[model samples]
Target: MNFEIPPGLTDLLQEFTVAVLRTRPSNLEAFAADYFNNLNEKKNGPLKLSGALRFQENDTVNIIEPSDGHGSSNEDDDDDSFVGPPSSYRDRRKSVSAERYDPEADDEGDYTKVVNPKSDEQRRRLNDAIKHILLFRSLDHEQMQEVLDAMFEKIVDPGEEIIAQGDDGDNFYLIDDGKYDIYVNIDGKRKLVGNYNNEGFFGELALMYNMPRAATIIAASRGTIWGLDRQTFRRIVLKTAFNKRKKYEKLIEGVPMLSSLDMYERMNVCDALSSQTFRDGQQIIAQGDKADCMYFVEEGNARVAMVNKADPTATVEKEISRVGPGGYFGELALVTNKPRAASVYSVGVTKLAVLDVHAFERLMGPCMDIMKRNIGHYESQLLHIFGDKANISDLR
Candidate 1:
């Protein structure tokens, strides 16, 4: 059948090719021929879009959104596509646009999806991916749902950049389908550091402090992902995590030196902490070794001790303190950046929430005031008396 090409229609196809394919226009005749054929034919299959159809251009920062108000379907053939563009190009050249979508026509819901048909699967996969990440553990079911409302899914082809290194972070992502290689600029060149597949997630660090993406995450193969915007993240996840962090503030508040920390300081402390578990007799701190962390026991018991410097090879010195639930230790060595005055080991299986001095200072630099009070006034005389006692009981 002989086909008549519309004026500027060839140009429009070229523009779409360049914008969506991320490739220079080539063989316009072949591209136009195929696109016209697909537009007029009623074919049934998934459609694959090559690049973001619409993205802000010539900007210093990269923040892309689907220009067509939707992304192409992931089809067998990687072409920028949508519900097979209306029955015939000759019949609808002026009206055929990338900006509109018909869900009834879109086999796979596009980028601006409001209600997901595969919501059950999406929720389960999203929760599973997020469960192990410390940053999201505090969110309750309702909050998780609110987060769900703000998220949407997308599929990227192999070699596509999911998140670029050194870009302003605008979204957090969870992998739902395939693998992606992680890279970070090391020294001067981009270095492959790691890879993550289904159920793995990244972009948390960027949200935590609004910092530039630390690493570039590229799709190792065609992959599907669920993404939440930075605004939704701060509104739902960050707010919830901060609220949950307050529940642990009492643990910080009870510590004499840390008692003076205000509520915001306490929240920062909670954010800086990590939960840990130690089996019975597991060494937590080594006596006379450089130590710079503190802990708060949340479950079970742990014993604190110091090396018997007098003998140099003693099995264990007298137990300095038996820390039960809610008790904390490691304040002395961590704050001073000195050799540990004592060693700590789990008595039975114990669980503790721990924070390193550097983390604490990084989260709140002024909080060093708390450490100064701990080491200079409280631990000074005790160290003079017990020599290397790891616990604060010597002062009591």
Candidate 2:
């Protein structure tokens, strides 16, 4: 008899076969053999009942006597009806341990273990977290991923030394969570310098230069850190920072006094000024100290004090002048490379733009000559008014 399989029945049979292959097997050899035989019989033989069997292939069936066939139909049917193996054997092997495998076990053992990070769906979350940890921004997606992949997380317990002072610096760290105390050896004491919290970073100066750790970073609380090794951190920082410094140099060149400086002179001034900072009430150019730089006050006020040493215990010390924003002081030091005749101290928090003596000489050579001539003219005017009784030579 010929069998006709509906389209829906054929599809259902195929899906059922796949499910059986995945889920049922005591002896894989016997299961495979029976599966193929049944498939072949369905393809070749006609079903006595229509739609009872699905045809996956087209071939003619040749009925043979029981003695001539591999097995009797009844025997084949009994074997076919046998359900193979436990369901647990058909289930996929799950990783039991990461270190080693058990050969007899169904578990995947060491093979499946991995440091699972954010999945594709959670990539934005990972990126945002990394963004907060990184010191510099402006990295594109691909570059950011490269950086993130290189970074590894670490946990530090309270009082642990994250980085020791005076040690040769290597890796730079970004705080992912918790806090750290920064300490530096000041006046032979380990002074608490500052505290770093989440998203804060340290060891940047090491990446810029192969300098020793300027301060020790200790965990004030149980902290988590994500670290990028020196090589990678340096590559990113150097490219960005160099470009930024160039922009700053251009801005500095716009200043009137420094505008006349040549590229080499400006570079020297830039290097010299890199180490300079001013605090409130800090004396920049002390009286009688050999002045090596000219300072342009970018912000805040400075008082210029002139002392009349002739009257050592004078009730009131002389106030020569005061300089505020846009004003430059210590130009005489740059011009003459002589001891400062007066002191200049910040009246409040100040930012100073400094030009070194060499830069001044190179940029303002002719200007210095004009200033000397003007000083002489003022001295003559003062001499005329004082009638030779007052000495005016020291005024310059």
Candidate 3:
């Protein structure tokens, strides 16, 4: 007897099977009803069906892919899907958490937090593993501690499959010990792509973007790995981003020069800014150099000093002023479009929110008027210090 499965039915069954294997709900009938309803909603929505997953507000399950001999062969067909860095052992190199993130819905109250205890040695190893991961790098001291608490260790045996190709992504894995082989399906044949030994991470792209696993990871020897559940990862990532934006927005709003910018304009400025840090005594800006960016002090302080260029042999710098938190500098060069008149250095361990000249011109149009209005005040200070040697071409 020949039993034929319709192509549409095959896709439906494939999705259902993956969902069930991952979720493993106690009641199959009830799970099926909810699964199909959610699946239908996702399908009918504006987004087309592909390698994308939606992280619901209330979902907590560590469902992995079942190797039922129906693995998709088209998983690795895309160009550049196999490119990797030295420790990269997977398919694709997309930016971490590139999907549109809505932090408001990712509140801690929405789901039960997972807290798996680890010994001091284990905690240190896990910290070292995830410290460099971009998805976890944005997390602060408290958030990082939360993440470490949520992670549980998984012991892998030789030849055991940790992640199967085409599986629904549920957890992000970081290697704590041992090695693993990576394989991808190419032309219906599994091809060895790469390996992760002692250090590396996989399954992040799938969790970050809600996409299917692009490669299979199998342990080559007994090893222990740390895993963070999907829900916690998303909540922490989104919430941290939201908080950082709000913090920077508050700082940008405090700048008197940019007070004229409306609410929406202020938000745009927040998006354009990038955080920077400098150790004590580090030179942030050099005098007479072309200024392409401005800085907003977020924490600590920066000293702005005027350098005497009249006597080239006797190079000297005089501290003119200090910029504290919520203060800004380097805008004069961007406004006057000339050489930097003063050099700025970090007074202590300083932090800054940097906005480049291009972003300044585009988003600071309204603020530019205010800056030009204060041009006389800036010029007067320069004239007071340099006397006849004051050159407007060198800027204020």
lDDT of 3 by residue, 295-334 (tens): 9999999998887676464367777679899988888889
Q: Which pairs clash (backbone N, Cα, C closer than 3 Å) in model 2?
A: 26-85
Question: By TM-score, how accurate is candidate 3?
Answer: 0.52
Question: For each candidate, what is the lDDT?
Answer: 0.56, 0.51, 0.66
Off by over 4 Å in 2: 1-254, 262-268, 310-315, 357-367, 370-392
Return the number of clashes found in candidate 2. Answer: 1
Model 3: number of backbone collisions: 3
TM-score-superior candidate, 1 or 3: 3
- Clashing residue pairs, backbone N/CA/C < 3 A, model 1: 46-75, 47-73, 47-74, 47-75, 48-73, 48-75, 54-67
**Ranking, lDDT, top scorer first:** 3, 1, 2
lDDT of 3 at 387: 70
| lDDT (tens digit, per residue) of candidate 1 on 342-394 | 77899889989887776544443445566556555545544554566334542
lDDT string for model 2 (1-396, tens) is 222222233222322232232334577456644644544453345333223232223532211100101111111111111122234323533212212111223233333222325456445544666564323443445656766666667888999877665555567676667877755443344545346556456665544434455556788899788777664554544443333344346546556655655443344344334324578889888877887778866678888765544444543434556777666778764555557756888887877766666546544553566556555654454455444443344555
TM-score of each: 0.43, 0.35, 0.52
**How many residue pairs clash in model 1?**
7
